[model samples]
Target chain A: MVPTSYYIILSAALFAIGVLGVLIRRNALVVFMSVELMLNAANLVLVAFARERLSIDGQVLVFFVITVAAAEVAVGLALLVAIFRTKHTTDVDEVSTLRG
Target chain B: MESLQIPPVDLRLLTPLLIVVGWASALLLIDVFFVPNGRKKITGYLAMAGLAVAGLAGIPLWNVSGSTFSGMLVLDRYSLALTWIFLIAGALSIAVALDYLPRHEIEQGEYYPLIMFAVGGMILMAQSADLITLFLGIELLSITLYILTGFAYPRVASEEAGIKYLVLGAFAAGFFVYGIALIFGATGTTSLAGIADYLSRQPFAPQDETLFLVGASLVLIGFGFKIALVPFHMWTPDVYEGSPTPVAAFMSVGTKGAALAALLRVTLAMEAARDFWLPLLAVLAAATMIIGNLGALGQSNLKRMLAYSSIGHAGYILLGIMVAAERGAEAFLFYMLAYTLTNLGAFGVLIALEQRGEAAWSIDDFAGLYQRRPMLAVAMALFMFSLAGVPPTAGFMGKFFVFTAAYAGGLGWLVLIGVITSAIAAYYYLRVVVKMFMQEPVRDVRPELTRGLNTEILIAGVATLILGLLPTPIVLLVEQSLVALGG
Candidate 1:
C-alpha cells in the first residue's frame, strides 16, 4: 500500500495541472474542464485526509462537493453550448464583446 | 466511534430562511400551474409577498442571541439585520423584474424560485458559525445565481456571462474547500471556534505558522473573488452586463453582503492571526479602489459602469473590515445598507426604462430624461449623486462612516486612496446626470413605468434620502447588532 504522502503529492500535481490549464488554455470548454480537474483534486485530498484522520465528516463533505460540482458543471456546459452557438467559437479570445 | 447525528433543527431560529424558501417554492408552483400562459405579474407578486413576509418575520429575531444546531449556526442581531437587507433587496428586485423580464420576452417561471433560494442561501451563510455550514451556504447561493445569470439561455451574451461566472466561481470555491481541508488538517476540526481554540493553545512553531498562514490565504482568495476585489474581479463587467438587469443587481449586493459578513465572522473569531490576513486585505482594499475606479472611466453602458463602481464600493467596505475594530462592523453594516438601497434604486429605474428595449440601457439614451419624466429624472439624479458619494444622501453617509472607520483603524492612506477614487467616480456618475438633465431630448420618449415600478422607485428614493439624513438610529441599531455578535 502506498503512503498517505503519495496521495498528497498526487493531489498537488493534479491541482498544478488544473491551474496551468486555466492559465494557458484559451478555449472556454478546456478551461472549464481544467476547473473540474481542480475540484476533483480537492476531493482526492479531502478523501485522503479523511482516511488519515479516521473521520467520516471529511468523506461526507466530499459527497456534498461532488453534488455541487455536478450542478455547476451542468449549468456551465449549458452556457458554453449557448455561447458557442451564437459566437461560432468556443475560444475565450473571440468572446470579448464587453471589453473596453 | 459514535456516529454524528444530524444537528438539532431550530424552527424559531430558522423562520426567516424558511419563509424565503417556502415562498420561493410557492412561486415556482404558481408559475408552473397558473402562469403557463406567461402571466409574469403573478410570479412577481408572489415573490414580493414571500420576501415581505420574510422581512417581517426577521424583525422578532433582531435582539435574540444564541448558537443553534450544535454550534453550526448562530442566531444573533448581526445575521438578522442582514436578513432584512437581503429580503428587501429581493423584494425590490422582484418588483423591477416584473417590468424588465416581460419586455425582453424572457420570462421564466424558475427565476423567482432561484432568487429566493439564493437569498435563503445568503441568510444561511450570514448565520453560519462553522466551516461546513459556510461552504454549504455559499454553494447554495452560487448555484442558484449560476442559473439565474443564464436564465435568458438563448441570448449569447447572457450565456457567456453565465459560463464566465461559473468557471471563476467554481475556481474560487475550489480554493475555499481546499483551504477548509488544510484548516481541518492543521487544527483537527472544522468549526471556527474550534480552530480558534486550537490555534490559541499551540505554541509558536515555524511549520505551524506556515500551515495557518497558507490556509488563511486560500480562504481569503475565495472571498476576494466573491466580493470582486481587483485581482479576482475580471469576471465582473462581463457577468454584470450580460445577465438580466435584475439578477445583476441582486448579485451585486446580496452576494457581496453575505460574503463580507462571513469573512468578518471567521477573521474575528480567529483573531490570533490578524497580523497575517489584515495587511493582505489592506493591499487588496487599496488596489481594488484604484483599479475599479480607473476601469470605469470610459464605460458607456450603464450596467458596466455600475459593475465597476460596485467594485470600488467593495474596496471601501474592505477598508472597514481592515479596521477589525468594534465600530468597524457597524460602519460596514451601515454602508452595505446604504449601498443596497441606492444600487437597487438605480437598477429599479434602469429596469423601468428597459420596458421599451435594451436600447434604452445606454448612457446616451438618458439624454433629456428630465424632459421625458420629471419625477424619474429627479429620482435617477438622487441615485447617481448617492452612488457618487455626494453629501445629503445615503451614499455620502455610507462613505463617511467607512472612511472614518478605516482612519480609526490606522488605514489612513487607504482612506486617502478611497477619497481620490470617489472624486474620479464623480466624473462618470455626473456624466449620466448631465445627459439626463442637460442634453436635448433626442428621441420622442414615453413614460413606460407601471404603477408598481413607480412605487418601487419612490420607496427607494425616500429610503435613500431618509437613511442619508437620519442615519444615527440605523447606525445605532447596526452597532447594537455588532456588539451582540461579540457577545
Candidate 2:
C-alpha cells in the first residue's frame, strides 16, 4: 500500500507546477487548464486523506469540487468566447484595453 | 440491506434563503415567458419585490436560531442581520440598474435575477457551518458575478474584465480547495465545530500543527484576493473600471461584505489558534489600509478610486474580525452596514453622472457641480465626506467603532496605522469634494437623474446621515446580533 506522505508530496508538486503554469502562461485557455490542474491536485489530496482516514467525507467533497469546477469552466469558456468574438484572440497580452 | 435514514431537516431555518433562491429561480422563468424586450425594468421591479419579501421573511426568524441540514447550515442573528443587508444591497442594485440598463442599452431581464442569485449565495455563505457549504456559496457567487461582469455585450473591455476576473477567481478557488483539503486531512473533518473540537482536545498533536496552519494561511489568501488586499488586489481597478457601473457598485459592497461575514465565522471557529492567526491578520490589516489608500490617490477614474477605497474599508473591517471573538462582532456588523450605505451611495452618484456614449467617470467631471446642479453636488459631497470618515457621517462612526474595538483588543499599533492611513485616505476622498465645489467644470456634461437613480441616492444618503447622527438604535441591534456559535 502507498503511504499517505507519498500522495501528499506528489499532490504538492502538481499544485506547484499548476501555480507556475498560471503565472508563466500567457494564453487564457492554458491558464484555465492550469487552474483545473490545481483543483485536481487538491482532489488527489482529498481522496488520499479520505482513504487514509477510512472516512467518506473527503471523497464526497471531491464530487462537489468537480461539480463546481465544471460550472466554473462553463462560465470561463463563455467569457473567453465573448472576448474572442471581439478581439479574435485569446492572448492575455492583447486584452489590455483596461490598463491605467 | 438496511433502510436508509435521513437526518431530520429543519425547513423553517432556511425560510429567508429559500425565499430568495426560489423567487430568483421563478423570476428567471417569469422573465423569459412574460417580460418583453424594452420592458426589462419590470423584471427589475419584480426582483426588488422578491428581496423585500425575503427581508420580511427574515424578520420573523430574528430571534430564532438553529442548525439545519445535519449542521451544514445555521440560522442565527449573525446570518439574519447580514441577510437584511444583502437584500437591501440587492434591491438597491436592481433599483440603480433599472434606469442605467435602459440608458446604456444593456437592458436584459436576466440581470435582475442574476443579482438575486448572487444574494442567495451571500446568505448561504453567512449561514454555512461547514467548509463544503462555504465553498459552494463562494462558487455560486463567483460564477454569477463572472456572467454579470461581462453582461455588457460586445464591449471588449467588459469581456476582458470578465475573463480576468474568472482566471483570478479560479486561481483563488484552487487555493481555497487545497486549504480545505489540508485542513480536512489534519483534522479528519470539514465541519467548523468538528475542527474546533479537534483543536481544543488534549495533547494537541504537534504533527498536525504545521498542516493546519498552512491550510489556514492559504484560505486567508483566497479571501485576500476576494477582498482586494494589497498583494492580491491587482484585478480590482481594471475589473471595476471595465464592468458596468451598477454591477461594479453591487460587487464592491456585496462580495466584500459576504466574504467578511464568512471570514468572521471562520476566524471565530478557529479561535483556539488565535496565537497563530491574530498577529498575521493584524499585519494584513495594517498593510491593506496603507496600500489601499495609497492606491486610490493616483486613480483618475471614479470606479477605480472607489475600488481602492473599498479595499481600504475592508481593511478597517478586518480589524473588527481580529477581535471578534472577544468584543469585535458588533463593530464589524455596524461597519458593514455603514460602509454598505456610504459606498453604494457614492457609486449611485457616479451612475447619475455616467452618460451613454462616454462614461463621465473622470474626477474632473465633477468640477463645478454645485453651480450646475446643487442637489446632486450636495449628495455627492455628502457621500465623499462619509467615505473620508469626516465628522457626523456613517463612515466616521464606523472608523471610530473599529479603532476603539482594536485598541481594546490590544491592537493599538494597528489602530494607529488605521488613523494615519485614514488621514491619508481623506485627501483622495475629499479630493472629489474639492473638485465638485471649487474647481471649474472641465467640460459641459449633464448628469441624468432618473427616478430610479434619484430614489437610490436618496435612500442611501438619508440612511447614511441618520445612522451617523443617531447610531444608538442600530448599534444596539448590532450588539444584540453578536454571533452565537452554539445555535
Candidate 3:
C-alpha cells in the first residue's frame, strides 16, 4: 500500500499550484479552471485520508465538494459571460470599473 | 442488512428554516408565472411576510435544545436567536428594496427569494453540528449573493463585482474544503462533538501536530475572507460600492452574522488547542479593527465608507470569538443584534437617496440633507453616532459588552487597540453627520420618499436607540441563549 504522507504531499503541491494560477492568471477562464484544480486537490486529499483511516466520511466529503464545484462552475461561467458581454474582455484587469 | 435505524427527525426544530425555504421557492414561482412586471412590490411584501413567520416560528422553539439528523443539526437558543436576527435583517432588506428596485427599473421577483434563501442559509450555519453542513450553508448563501450582486445586469460595475465575488468566494471555499480534509485526516471525523471528543482524548502531538494546526489555520483563513478581515477585505469596498444598495446592505449584516456563528462553533470544537488559536485571533482582531478604520478615513463614497465600517464592525465582533469563554458568546449575540439594527438603518438611508442610473453616494450629495429632510437627516446622524460607538445608541452598548468580555478574557491589549481604532472610526462617521447637517445640500440626492423606506429607517433608528438605552431585555435574551459547544 502506498504511504499516506506521499498522498498528502502531492495534494499540497497541487493545491499550491492551483492557488498560484489563481493569483497569477489574468484570464477569467484560466482562473476558474485553477479554482477547479484546487477543489480537485482537496478531493484528492480527502480520498487519500479516507483510505488511510478506513472511514467513509472523507469519501463522502469528496462527493460533496465535487457537487459544489460543479455548481460553482455553473455560476462562475454565467457571470463571466455577463461580464464579457459588457466589457468584451475576459481579462480580470480589464474588468476594473469600480474605484475607491 | 439489519434495518438501519432512522435518526429521530424533529420537524418542529426545523420550522424556521422550512418556512423560509418553502416561502422563497413558492415566491420565485409566483413571480415568474403570476406576478406582473409592474406589480413586483407584491413579492417584496410576500418576502417580508415569510421572514416574519419564520421569526415567529422561532418563538415556539425558544426553549427547544437538542441535536438531530445524526447530529448534523442542533436546535438551541443560540441558533434560534441568530435566526431571529437573520429574519429581521432579511425583512428589513426587503422593505428597503421595495421602492428602490422599481425606481431603478431593475425590479425582479428573484431578489426576494434570494434574500430569503440567504437568510435560510444563515439559520443553517447557526444550527450546523457538522463541518459539512456548515460548508453547505456558506455555499448556499454565497451562491445566492453572487446572483443578487449582479442582478443589476448591463451595468458593468455590478457584473464586475459579482464576478469578483464569485471567483474569490470559490477560492475561499477551496481552502475551506482542504482545511476540512486536513482536520478529518487528523481527527478522523467532521462532527463538532466527535472532534471535541478526539481532541480531549488524544495526547498532545507537540512537534507532530503540523497537520492539525495547518488545517485549523486554513479554516480560519476561509472565515477571515468571509468576515472581511483586513488582508482578505480587498473585495469588500468594490463589491459593496458596485452591488445594488439593498443587496450590499443585506450581505454586510447577513453574511457576517452567519460566518461569526460558524466561527464560534469551530472555536469551541477546538478548545483543547486554545494555546494555538487564542493569540492568533487576538492579532487578527486587532489588525482587522485598525485597517478597517484607517481604510474608511479617506473614502468619499458613502457605500464604500459603510463597507469599511462593516469591516471594522466585523473586527469588533471578532473580539467576541477571541473571548468566547468569558461572556464572549453573549456579547457576540448582543452585538449582532445591535450592529444589524444600526448598520441596516445607515444603509436604508443610503438606499433612500440613491437615484436610478447614477451613483449618488458621494458626501457632497449629503449636503443640505438637514434642510430638505430634517427627520431623515437626524436619523442618519443617529446611525452614524451608533456606528462610531457613541453613547445612547445600540453600537455603544455592543462595544461596551464586547470590550468588557474581551477584557475579562485577558485581551486587554486587543481591547485597547479596539478603543483606539474606534476613536479613529468616529472621525469618518462624524464627517458624514457633519456633512448632512452642517453643509448645504450640493445635490438634491433625495429621491421621492417611499413609505416603506421611511418605515425601515424609523424602525432602524428607534431600534438602535432602544437597544442602546434599554439593552436589558436583549442582553438577557442573549445571555440565556448561550447554549453552545456541548455546554
Candidate 4:
C-alpha cells in the first residue's frame, strides 16, 4: 500500500495546481474546472486519511463533498451558459462592465 | 464489522430549520404548478410565513442547551438568537424583494425559496457542532446565493456577478474542505468536543502542531472571503453592485452574521491555540477596518458604497470575535442585530429608488430626495447615522459594546483602530446623508415603491433608534446567549 504521507503530499500538490489554475485562467469554464480539481484533491486527501485511520468518517465526508461539488458544477455551468448567451464569450476579463 | 446503531434524531431541536427549508421547497413547487407568473408574490408571502413560524419555533427553544444528531448540531441560546436574526433578515429581504422583483421584471418563483434555502443554510451554520456540518452549511448557502445573484436572466451584469461569485465561492470551499482534512489529520476527529479534548492536552507533537495551525489558517481564509475581509474582499464591490439590491442586502447581513457565529464557536473550541491565532486575527481585524473604510470613500454607487461599508462593519464585528473570551460574543451578537436593521434599512432606500433597468443608484440620485420623499429621506438619515455609529442609534450602541469588550480583553490597539476607522467611516456614511438632506435633486422623476417598503424602512429606523437608546436589554440577552462561550 502507498504510504499515507505520500498520498497527502500528492493531494497537496494537486490542490496547489488547482489554485494556480483558478488564479491564472481567464475562461470561466477553465476556472470552474479548476475548482472541481481542487475539490477532488480534497477528496483524495480525505479518502487517504480514512484508509490510514481505518475509520469511515473521512470517507463519509468525502461522499458529501462530492455531492456538493456536483451541485456546484451544475450551478456554475448554468451560470456560464446564461453568461454566454448575452456576452458571446466566456472570458472573465470581458465581463467587466461593473468595475470600480 | 459490528452493526451500527442509528443516531437518534431530535425533531424539536431542528424545528426552525425543518420549517424553513421544507416550506421553502414546497413553496417553490407550488409556485411552479399553481401560481401564475404575475402572482409569484404568493410564493414570497408563503416564504415569509415560513420564516415567521420558524422564528416563533425558535422562541420556545431559547436557553435550551444540548447537542443532537450525535453531537453534530447544537441547540442553545446562541443558536436560537441567531435563528431569530436570520429569520428576520430573510423576511425583511422578501419584503424588499416583493415589489422590486416584479417591478424589475425578474419575478422568478425561485427567488423567495432560494432566500429561504439560504437562511436555512445560515441556521445550520449557527447550529453546527462539527466541521462537516459547517462546510455543508457554508456551501449550501453559497450555492443558493450564486444562483440568486444571477436571477435577472437578461442582465449581463447580474450574470457576471453570478459567475464571479460561483468561481470565488467554490474556490473558498476548496480551502474550507482541505482545511477540514488537515484538521482531521491532526486531531483524528472532526467533532468540536474531540478537538477541544485534544488541544487541551499539553505538548503536542511537532507534526500535529503544524497540521493544526496550517489547517486553522486555511479555514480562516475561507471564512475571511465569505465575510469580505480586507485581504479577500475583491469580489464584494462588483458582486454587490451587479446583483439586485435586495439580494445584495440580504447577503451583506446574513452571510457575515452566520459566518461569524461559526467562527466564534471554532475559536472557542480551539481556545488552547489562542497564542497561535489571536494575534493573527487581531492584525486581520485591524487591517480589515482600515481598508474597508478607505474603500468606501471612493465609491459613488449606492450599492457599492454600502458594500464597502458592510466590509468595514465586518471588521468591527471581527473586533467582537477577537474578544470572544470577554463578553465579545455578546457584543458580536448585538452588533449583528443592530447591523442587520441599520444596513437593511439603508439598502431598502436604494431598492426604493433603483429604477427598472436604469440603475438609478448614484449618490447624486439621492439629491433632493428630502424634497420628494421626506420620510424616506429621514429613514435614510437614520440608517446612515446608525451605520456611522452616531450616538442614539443602534450602530452607536453596537460599536460601543464591541469596542468596550475589546478594551476589556486588553486589545487596546484593535479598539483604537476600530475607533479611528469608524470616524473615517462616518465621512462616507455622512456623505450620503449630506446628499439626501442638503443637495439639490438631480432629477424630478422618481420611481414608485411599495407600501411594504415603507414598513421596512420604518421598522429599521425605529429599531435602530430604539436599540441605540436602550441597549441594556438586548445586551443582556446577548450576554445570556454567549454563556456557552464562557462570556
Candidate 5:
C-alpha cells in the first residue's frame, strides 16, 4: 500500500504549483484555473488522509469541495464574460479601473 | 449489516436559518414568475420581511442552546445575537438599495434574494461547530457576495471588482480547505469539540503537532483575508469602490462581523494551543490597525476610505477575539453591533449623495453639505464622529469596552496601538465632517433622497447614538448571551 506521507508530499507540491500559477499568471482564466487546481490538491489530501485513517468523513468533505468548486467556476466564468464584454480582455492587469 | 441510524435531527434548533434560506429560495422563484421588471422594489421589501420573520423566530429560541445535525450546527444565545445583527444589517442594506438600484438602472429582482442568502450564510458560519460546515458557510457567503459585487453588470469596474473578489476569495477558500484537511490528518476529526478533545490528550507525535499548527495558521490566513487584515486586505478598497453602494455597505459590516464571529469560535476551540496563536494574532492585529489606518489616510474616495477604515475596525475587533476566552466575547458582540450601525449609516449617507455617473464618491462632493442639506450633513457628521470613537457615540463606547477588555486580558500594548490608530483615524473621519459642515459645495450635486434611504440612515444614526449613550442594556444582554463553547 502507498504511504500517506508520499500522498501528502505530492499534494503539497501540487498546491505550491497552484499558488505559483495564481501569482505568475496574468490571465484571469488561468489564475482561476490555478485556484481550482489548489482546491483539487486539497481534495487529494483529504482522500489520502481519509483512506489512511479508514474514515469516511474526510472523503465526504471532498464531495462538498468539488460541488463548491463547480459553483465557483460557474460564477467565475460568468464574471469573466461580463468583464470581457466591457473591457474586451481577461488579463487581470487590464481590468484596473479601480485603484488607489 | 445493521440498519444505519441517522443522528437525531433537531429541526427546532435550525428554525431561524431554515426560515432565511427557505424564504430566500422561495423569493427567488417568486421574483422570476410574479415580479415585473420595473417593480423590483417589491422583492426588496419581501426580502426584508423574510429577514424580519427570521429575526423573530430567533427571539423564541433565545434561551435554547444545543447542537443539531450531529453537532455540526449550534443553537445558542451567542448565535442568536449574531443572527439578529446579520438580519438587521441585511434589512438595512436592502432598504438602502431600494432606491439606489433603480436610480442607477441596475435594479434586479434577484438582488434582494442574494442578500438574504448571504445573511443565511453568515448565520451558518456563526452556528457551525465543524470545519466542513464552516467551509460551506464561507463559500456560500463568498459566492453570493461575488455576484452582488458584479450586479452592476453594465459597469466595467463592477465586473472587474467581482472577478478580482472571486479570484482572491477562491484562493482563500483553497487555503481553508487545505487547512481543514491538514487538521483532520493530524487529529482524525474535523469537529471543533473533537479537535479540542484530541488536543487535550496532548503528548502527540511531533509530526502531528507541526501539522496542527500549520493547519491552524492556514485557517487563520483564510479568515484574515475574509476579515480584511493588513496583508490580506488588498482587494477591499477596489471591491468597495466598484461595487454598488449598498452592497459595499453590506460587505463591510456583514462579512467582517460574521467572519470574526466564526474566528472567535475557532480560536476558543483551540484554546489548548493559546501560547502558539496569542502572540501571532496580537502582532497581526497591531499591523492591521496601523496599516489599515495609514491606508485610509490617503484615499480620497469615500468608499475606498471606508474600506480601509473597515480594515482598521477589524483590527480593533480582533483585540476582543484575542481575549475571547476571558471577557472578549461580550466586547466583541458590542463592537459588532456598534460597528454595524455606525458603518451602515455612513454608507447610507454615501448612497444618498450618489448620482448616476462614473465619477462619483469624491470627498469633495461632501463640500457645502450643511448649506445644501442640513439634515444629511448632520447625520453624516454624527456617523463620522461615531466612527472616529467620539464619546456619546456607539463607536466610542465600543472602542472603550474593547480596550478595557483587552487591558483586563493583559494585552495592554494592543489597546495602546488601537488607541493611537484611532487617533490617526479621527483625522480622515473628521475631514469628512469638516468638509460637510464647512466647505463650499465643490460640485452642486443634488442628493437623490428617497424614503427607504432616509429610513436607513435614520435607523442607523439614531441606533448608533442610542447605543453609544446607553450601552448598559445591550452590554448586559451580550454578557448573558456568552454561552459556554462546548468545544
Candidate 6:
C-alpha cells in the first residue's frame, strides 16, 4: 500500500509544475492548460484525502469542483477562440492594446 | 438514519433576490416576444423600475435576521444594506446604459436583463453563508459580466478584455472551489459557521497547518482577483478601458462590494485563522496601495486613470478589513457607499462626454470642459476632489474612518502609507481638474452631452455634493448595520 505522504508529495509536485508553466509560458493557451493542470492536482489531493478518511463530503466537493471546472473551461476556450480570431495570435505579450 | 425535514422557502428572506431574478426573467421574456427587433428602450426603464421596487422591498427586511435554505443563506443587515447598494447601482447603470448603448450602436435588448441577472447574483453573494451558495452566486455574477465586457463583439480590444477576464476569472473560480473542498474536508462541513466552530475547537497541528493555510490562501486569492488587489489585478485596467464605460462603472462597485462582504464574513467568522490571513492581507493591502497609485501616475487615458484609481481605493477599503474591528466594518461600509456615488458620478460625466461611435476616453478630450459645459465640469471636479480625499467630501470622511480604524487597530504604519498614497493620488486627480479648468479648448472638439437627461445629471451632481458635505447620517447607518452584524 502507498503511503499517504507519497500521494501528497506527488500532487504538490504536479501543482508546482503547473504554477511554473503558467508563470513562464507566454502563450495564453499554455497558461490556461497549466491552470487546468493545477486544478487537477488539487482534485487529486482531494480524492486521495477522501479515500484515506473514508468521508463522502470531500468526494462530493470534488464532483462540484469538476463541474465548475468544466464550465470554466468551456467559457475560457470560447474566449480563446474569440481572441485568436481577432488578434491572430495566442501569445500573451501581443494582446497588449491597453497596457500602460 | 432519520430523514431530515427540509424547511419551507421563506419568501420574505429571499425577497430581494427573487425580485431581481423575476425582473431579469421578465425582461428576457419581454426581449424574446414583444421586442424581437430589439428597439426596446422601455426595457431599460422597466429594469430600473424593477430594481427600485426591489430596493423598496429590501427596506422592510433590514432588521430581519435569519438563515434559510438549509442554512445556505443568511438574511441580515449586512446583506440587506449591500442589496440596496447593488439595486441602486443597477438602476443607475441602466439609466447610463440606456443613452450610451444606443449611441455606440450595440443596442441589444438583452443588455438590461443581463445587468439585472448580474445584480441578482451579487445580492445572493452578499447573503450567502455556505460555500456552495457562494460559488453559485459568484458564477452567476461572473458569467454575465464576461459577456457584458465584450458586448461590442468583433472589436479587437473588447474581445481581448473579455477573453482575459473569462480565463482569469475561471482560474480564480477553480482556486475558490479547491479551497472550499479542502476547507470542507478539514472541518467536515461547508457552512462558514460550522467551519468556524470546528477551527475554534481544534488545536493547530503542524501537519495540518499546510492544508489550513493553503485552503484559506486559495479562498483569499479568489477574492483578491475579484477585488483586483495587487498581484491579482492584472486584468482590471484592460477590462475597464476596453469595456463600455457604464459596464466598467457598474463592475467597479458591484464586484468589489460583493467580494469585500464575503471576505469580511469569512475572515471574521473563521476566528481561529486570523493569525494566518491578517498579515498576508496587510501586505497585499500595502502593495496594492503603492502599486495602484504609482500605476495611475503615468496613465493618460481618463478611464484607465480611474481604473487604477479604483484599484488604489480597493487597497484603502482593504485597510478596513485588515483592522478587523467593528469600526472597521463600519468604515468599509461607509467607504463603499461613498465610492459607489462618486464613481457613478464620475462615469456619468464620462458617458455624457463620450462621442457617438468613437472612444473619447483620453485625458486631452476633457480640455476646457469647464468652458464647454460648466455643470459637467463642476460635477467632474466634485468627483475628482471626492476621490482624492479632499476635506468636507464623503471620500475624505470615508478615508479618515478607514485610517482611524487602522490606527486604532495598531496598524499606524499602514495608515501612514495610506495617507501618503492619498496625497500621491491627489496629484493625478487634480491634473484632470486642471485640464478641465485651465487648458485651452482644442479646435473642433465637441462631445455629446445631450443624450442624457438633465434630471440624471442633476441627481448625480447633487448626490455627490450632499454626500460629501454631510455624511454623518450615512456613517451612522453603516455603524448601526455593523453593530447588527454582532462584530
- The candidate scoring highest on lDDT is 5
lDDT of 1 at B403: 90
- Encode model 3's per-residue lDDT on B273-382: one tens digit a residue: 89998888878888899999999999999999999999999999999987888999999999999999899999999988898867789988888899989998999999
Give one digit per residue, the lDDT tens place, for model 2 in B1-487.
9998999999999898899999999999999999999989999999999999999989988889999998999999989999999999999998889988888898899999999999999999999999999989999998999999998865678888899999999999999999999999999999988988888884567767888888999899888888877688889988998899999999999999999999999998898888989888888898899989999999888889999999899899999999885568888899999999988888999998898888889999999988888898998888888888997989889988998999999999999999999899999988899999999999888989999989999999998899889999999888788746532
Q: Write the per-residue lDDT of candidate 2 for residues A20-93, one digit (tens) a residue.
A: 99999999999999999999999999999999999999999999999999999999998887777767644555
lDDT (10s digit) by residue, model 4, range B1-487: 9999988988899899999999988988898999898999988888899999999888888767788999999888889999999999999999999999988999998899999999999999999999999999998899999999988766789988988988999999999999999899888899988898899996889987898898999899899989988788889999998898899999999999999999988998889999888988887888889998999999888888899899999999999888888888889999999999999999999989988867877899999899899988999999999999999999999999999999999999899998999899999989988998999998764956687788888899899999999888888888788777562
Quick one: ranking by DockQ, best first? 2, 5, 3, 4, 1, 6
CA lDDT of every candidate: 0.85, 0.90, 0.90, 0.90, 0.93, 0.83
- How many Å off is the CA of B398 in candidate 3? 0.4
Residue runs of model 2 more than 4 Å from their true location after superposition: A88-96, B483-487
lDDT value for candidate 1? Answer: 0.85
For candidate 2, give the DockQ.
0.72
Q: What DockQ, on C-alphas, does every prediction get?
A: 0.51, 0.72, 0.69, 0.65, 0.70, 0.44
Candidates 2 and 3 compared by DockQ, better number: 2
| Candidate 4 Cα RMSD after full superposition onto the native fold (Å) | 2.0
Candidate 2 - CAPRI tier?
A: medium
Error of 3 at B235 (Å): 0.6
True contacts kept of 2: 0.85
* lDDT by residue for model 5 (B85-135), tens: 999999999999999999899999999999999999999999999999998
Write down the TM-score of every candidate. 0.95, 0.98, 0.97, 0.97, 0.98, 0.93
Candidate 2: residue B393 lDDT (0-100):
89
Error in Å for residue B334 of model 1: 0.4
Highest DockQ against the true fold, candidate: 2
When 5 and 6 are scored with lDDT, the better candidate is 5
Q: Which ten residues in a row have the lowest lDDT in candidate 1 chain B?
A: B352-361
Every candidate's chain B TM-score = 0.96, 0.98, 0.98, 0.98, 0.99, 0.97
